[model samples]
Target: MGRGTAAGTVCFAVANQKGGVAKTTSSISLGVALSDLGYRVLLVDLDPQACMTFSLGLDPDQLERSVHDVLVGDAEAAEVVSATEDGPDLLPATIDLASAEALLLTRTGREYALRNALEDLLEQQAAAGTPYDFVILDCPPSLGVLTINGLTAAAEVIVPLQCETLSHRGVGQLLETIADVRKMTNRGLQVRGILPTMFDARTTHSRDVLDDVAMRYELPVLEPPIARSIRFAEAPAAGRSILRTARRTRGAQAYADHAKSLAGEREAAS
Candidate 1:
């Protein structure tokens, strides 16, 4: 596979400035869903908390290498990638990543660190005849250097939001960051859509907030809101996505549908 043939790899940064918005959950679940569709996917844990790494059943404390190592050039991106039982590959994170922002601040072209690393890995994988189809980044809970690297690397952004006032507060700030990123770094970056996570259809307030957000931002709300489910919390303990831990549940089904919708959109765009 040549470099030109590797353009099919789509990178997504699942980002929101606010914590507990299901960024890691959506990243893992969506990667699993895409893998279920036979696409080779890689989930990159950009959060210093290593939530995505721990969520996939890996103990970050015990890892010899992580995304932090890759970012600091101590390791290649491929070296940090581990296979998950759920199907997609993961570039795990560790608490050591907390210092990555400060380290990157002194470096030139720091925002392209993730993009350059991922592109090199993708080229190698393409040469190996097993190219990844997608790369999903689980960004940190802040708009710091790590998240900026994520936004700069990704071609599109997926913001997972809880349907509530406090959760919605950061959307404007996130959009502003996206606007800045588009102007300053990744000119092709776009907000794919807003993903409503931990949504409860039974509550009228949830519905109202969702509608208001869509109207206010004039952004597409990705279909099939993920229903509030305890299974999301339970999956991490089991080292799998909700798709596997509770395959028949509403949340898993919604994510499966979302992945299929994303594939359809990609096809249409192509």
Candidate 2:
């Protein structure tokens, strides 16, 4: 319901209904980049797949508690939050999250579950003088209850669009979902813009797709598109972001620049 935390934590949901669009990658990268800028960040693994959790070097299967516990009312978010080696705190996910939808469907005001949990956590953290500067929600590949919770909780949504024809196909539908979330749950929710990922300037198709989506959806396309790099694939294996694994790579630099711009925007707004 609130646009940000009392301590000014800007929440972002990196969402795209389509899979393999670098949603998790962007989430982890941005979180780490923000942390590198000396801000405290929290990365919430809302996806049942737990890709972000594992990518951050945490094993979802071995975890005693997770975000699933928080969402199901069995545990508070602070109780389940863990520190990642990569500089950000994480509310990890497990396969049990796959059942959260069915369980939440029977609960009243289910869509606000995440928003309420995070608000409570923020209050607790702020009281302790350890407030986060950013919260990044890595949404799943489907517009399910989990994704709805993410949208309802975040003040802004960053849609990661792979530079391909089919990648932009679901942008319209996702936009409609955001609009509905605004009307029903989080009226303060806004689309940060479409983030072009895995862009290949060497190909005209990549350039064309980026141009077409911006014009068609009338959404701001963030500058310096993330280029395709094998380093992105290798980082997960190393349990780090591209920023750490390949610090000097173009893809890593793009995310750093993006994070700086985001931090600057928040500063400007304040």
Candidate 3:
């Protein structure tokens, strides 16, 4: 309903238990779009696969520090933050993050680990007068400890749904996990909306799935669904978001408009 913290930063976790729903794409696109609008933004890569990290043009293997280090308490989040060419600062991840799950499981209050880390980062940034306006977390495609941490740290969750049959099968399960997170960890966590990605406007099946999701879940479907595009795939190779690489494309324009709408909502809410 409101921003996550009193510090005025709105943290969004783009998550879905099912993969290939454009979670990473949405995270990068949204963050970059917001940054382009002059908002200070941070994008955190919580996926062990480091797709976001690689997509932002960073070599996870070459990095000496990652979100794994921050989670393990070996490094502060500020120390791991790297400025990306995509306009937003990044908290990169590596394969080592996969082990963080077992490590965090053995630790007490593991669900709040990400929240604590981000809060500390936000405080430090605020003190420097460069506070971020938004934080976008690209959660791993699972309901594991990592995703739990991401959910716990975020104020809102954006479910990126592919408008295809069976693609939304996991939305129900994810809602259950969000409910559990609210009951146990972060009560302020809210579902922002379902974002349709890779949408085929020409297909009635796509429209059918969107309608069914809205009717069944009673959740709002964000407007101007991101149309399916090969350009989305190509942008990552250049280590940039579609907004930067394919500025004139419909998919890019959709994300830009989505970011504006979300930002405008936050402003209106405030």
List runs of model 2 lying over 4 Å from the truth: 1-4
Give one digit per residue, the lDDT tens place, for model 1 in 1-270: 111234577788999989998999999999999999998999999998898998898999999989988888889998889998899999999899999999989999998888889988988987888878888999999999999999998888998989986567878889999999999998888888889999999889887898898888878898889999988889888888889889999999999999998777666655
Selected candidate, larger TM-score, 1 vs 2:
2
Clash pairs, candidate 1, are: none
Q: Rank the candidates by lDDT, best first.
A: 2, 3, 1
Q: Tell how far residue 226 is off in model 2, in angstroms.
A: 0.3
Error of 3 at 20 (Å): 0.7
**Residue ranges of candidate 1 with Cα displaced over 4 Å:** 1-5
- Give per-residue CA lDDT, model 2, range 95-154, as digits (tens): 999999999999999999999999999999889999888899999999989999999999
Worst 10 residues of 1 by lDDT: 1-10
Question: Candidate 3 on 1-270: residue-level lDDT in tens?
Answer: 128456689999999989889999999999999999999999999999999999999999999989998998899999999999879999999999999999998999999888899999989987898888999999998999999999999989999999998776989999999999999998888898999999999889999999999889889999999999999999888988999989999999999999999789778866
Local distance difference test values of all predictions, in order: 0.88, 0.93, 0.92
